[model samples]
Target: MATATYPPPPPFYRLYKDYNENPKSIPEHPPPIEGTYMCFSGNYTTDDVLPSLEEQGVRQLYPKEPNVDFKKELGSLNRELQLHILELADVLVERPSQYARRVEDISLVFKNLHHLLNSLRPHQARATLIHVLELQTQRRKQAVDDIKSGEKSCRNFSWSLSEP
Candidate 1:
């Protein structure tokens, strides 16, 4: 059977392109906290500057940012994963009739998942794995249902042709 290939999904490609074009900037200062607060001097309108203060406090109190770059790095990795999956989906759609190709695509997905989970901390990895598995299960079930429906329709058509 011939294998087919498709381009990345629209959203995935868009996100990938955006990431490629505009990589996130790691802030030199910490991100700002939302709300007003009081300082020893008096009532201080601490808007965004407090992130540095908060960061200093954290640094002084703790050994380090225990989850260093947790937000930014995970977010970037997630984008990469999304792009990979979208590419895989495109390939699978193109090669629907090729069992070997489908297998290869699925294996690639598992490998990606494995690598992603391994890259995360244990707690975070567990949470991410659960969500990813749920999504995969739902999509796979829908695909299976669609294939079954198509097969049934084909069978019905063949029967009708033989009868007439």
Candidate 2:
């Protein structure tokens, strides 16, 4: 009787095991704080630097600027920034850079951004669903290739030896 040989473990098995063992091992960054603040001691007024400062969570500390509209500006700026990142992600996925050694990293970035957008805009659930489906399709193709390679190795081994 002959025993069937199994293929070696996949590269991602270690990652899967680590994830399953400690799902919370990844540290989460805090949500962005929105505030307006002064930049320089020159002629530039606080208003001149408020928008950029608020985007980075540096709001005015003085009571005189009590009416500062940081929240509104931050909301708009956050949305715009998110959209910009999404556009850049799309381009990267479409034509990955030759210097990128790990294409999966880029894919994960897109996946996270898609999730972020979905959470921010529940109305776009359908579009998010489509994006996830596409990612899954790509993963499926990679899995199929692995299986095919394993099968070829088994076939070659079986044909090379004589009956015992």
Candidate 3:
């Protein structure tokens, strides 16, 4: 009998790579505002929110079926949106010549979309923003520590060079 070789699991880094490489491959749903709404005084997951909209003849923008892991899925969606914004920013920053005007226009559109996504769920949006800020602060502190350690090593190296 011959042993079979299995392919390795896809890396987490490349989970979004396909979509990033060809965004158009993923069908674009209309913006969330196109959906119908039902006012609820209580908390609701994306699943809870979908039926009401569907009943009102509003198409659900999300490709996933209901009862999926809303929290994780929503996080992934938000992450994708943020990545899109960052990619646009990078393009804008890199092209200071002919693309400047185009960059400005796309950047403004990105900002509006980003703002709309964030505004959809106020509490969740605030929490996500806070989490991001905390992570950024931690990264900055680590960077500062690394620089200080490097400086100290350099200082010691110079002192040793000066001695004897």
63-107: candidate 2 lDDT, tens digit per residue: 224353544544544665566566667767786573253443444
TM-score of 1: 0.26
Better of 1 and 2 by lDDT: 1
TM-score, candidate number 3: 0.29
Please estimate how well model 2 matches the true structure, expressed as its whole-model Cα lDDT: 0.55
**Which 10-residue window in model 1 sums to the lowest lDDT?**
55-64
lDDT of each residue in 1-164, candidate 3, tens digit only: 97559866667645456796787665556666433455686543444332333454443334435354545545755675676567667766786455565555545444444434543675687889999999999999999999999999999999999999
Better of 2 and 3 by TM-score: 3
Q: Any runs in candidate 2 off by more than 4 Å, and if so which? A: 1-124
lDDT of 1 at 87: 65
Is 2 or 3 the stronger prediction by lDDT?
3
Q: What TM-score would each prediction reach against the true structure?
A: 0.26, 0.26, 0.29
Off by over 4 Å in 1: 1-59, 62-121
- Best candidate (score: lDDT): 3
